[model samples]
Target: MQAEGRAPGVREVAAAAGVSRQTVSRVLNDHASIRPETRARVLAAMEELDFRPNRAARMLTTARSRTIGVLASSASSLFGPASSIDAVEDAAREVGYAVTVAHAASLEPFDLGAALDHLRAQAVEGVVVIAPQQRVQDAMAHLALTVPSVTLHGAGDAADEGVFVDQLRGARLATRHLLERGHRRIAHLAGPGDWSEARARREGFLAEMEAAGADAVVSREGDWTAASGAEIGAELVADASITAVFASNDQLALGVLHAARLAGRDVPGDLAVVGFDDIPEAAFFAPPLTTVRQEFAELGRRCVARLVALIEGGDLAFEEPVAPVLVVRESS
Candidate 1:
């Protein structure tokens, strides 16, 4: 057995194969000039020595770690972001790349800088920043990125090297669904005002309302938590004029459901509610939730495809963004 500190190195493998270290390196790197007999001998030597190439050493030679760094925020803990991250990991692995994630303490430049520094030390070929907040975006503008990087969920109108859920369209779908149900005095329970998705969703909600000529524009902000949702949900529907609600996320919608029940309001009878994300538990709610579904799996696949392109020097247009799907349930 190899000692922990004496793991087989390239020199050892080359010696065992009776070849020079350069020959071993070329064989490992698939240089294509090596003869098949020599390659087979090297492979047999590696199997005998159980040699694994040092990643750092390979990085120095090839200038490619073949790894991607993910600088994520609270999104990693949330359903949407977590699902997207899982998708990215799967997609990255499929394309023969490894993923390393660094969660920022906050999206502050200092925090983001620290995460970037960590990934750079690992010699990653590129980075994906899931900057959902404007503050993160603001800090990102001044930071110097040495490797190819792409921002996600933060780009404004311009279609850059990033991807975003079409929140505006999603919000419009939720709002229009309510409007079609004959809900005119509908109120919006939004996530943190600081989030791009939150702002886009709010904008979509208002746009749809105005387009439908619905005069009511009631709205309140929440922290994307059920507690915040419940607290604000109570106040949002207190006026009795609001017959329906469109929450920015499933948690907020759950809060609305709880609040309505506490107020003796029958869901979809006295007050209808809709949420976003279509989280796994959304359907299991007391009444299955009516909500907008962001294609997180697709979101992940595209980010990997885009970032890989950027890394490989390809300026490929990604497959178009998949629009959000509306899941109509008993809630709305």
Candidate 2:
């Protein structure tokens, strides 16, 4: 047979490499049963000929597009969904899968259903929803998709396969750290009530304060923004009795830091401040804020792994609550 100056076909490559066409197929498909040496040989031959596998043909044969869908909230949020997206993409690529991202920013009840339906129509093998807000969780609670689905930051009843960091534990750590620093009157600058993270942190702070036999000052709700943090921080400063404050997130904590400077209160000298999320800026805050570090990337990777297992009909167990670490810095 006369071979043209084109990339070799699988059969030609297999013949050249002294392997069966089926062996080449298995190697290209990344089947684990093939011997490593055999796979190396097939891969070398294909490389020598610059042969590229036809993705369309492969998808048709396998009935899989080799893609997973990630449904998350606003992509603009650096701390949560955005971090998760990066982690999922990195982990999926490591396992030979591609990721498609869908943002459910509004997460309206109807919109949540529509988003899931849309991802399903795209032929995704599985879907992951990163729902931190209670409304988003409620929206997902009514979904009955047979396609394997997992939720991140979901409440107790959204999905059986859910992943969440221990926000309560994080709060306790932040509050306890301040208490150890000799701050008796501690207040909370909480995130919006709609968010599960914020609520969990509030509960954790309350629990730790009651356990320490210290007075629990009323919490001021912030919208997880620097402006809200500044506003609430000023209020706490005006009260004259609050000596320590725990902000739900780093952004808000930055605002609190600013408010403290404006009020001429020396951090850890006149007042102590702690925050959560331990964002990159947290380490560079004026006094290098003490905070809790939530492993956003790890959470994302685990969520995808569990969803993929469910999609593949594999028996997998849900992971227990992930722990958050307290990062000690100059702020406290």
TM-score of each: 0.85, 0.89
What are the lDDT figures for the candidates, one per model? 0.85, 0.80
Q: Give the candidate number with the greatest lDDT.
A: 1
Local distance difference test, candidate 2: 0.80
Worst 10 residues of 2 by lDDT: 154-163
Question: Using alpha carbons, what is the TM-score of model 1?
Answer: 0.85
**For each candidate, C-alpha RMSD in Å?**
3.5, 3.1
Tens-digit per-residue lDDT, 31-102, candidate 1: 899999999999999999888777778888997788999988855698877887788889898987889998
Candidate 1 local Cα displacement, residue 70, angstroms:
1.0
TM-score of 2: 0.89
Off by over 4 Å in 2: 1-22, 45-55, 155-162
Off by over 4 Å in 1: 1-54
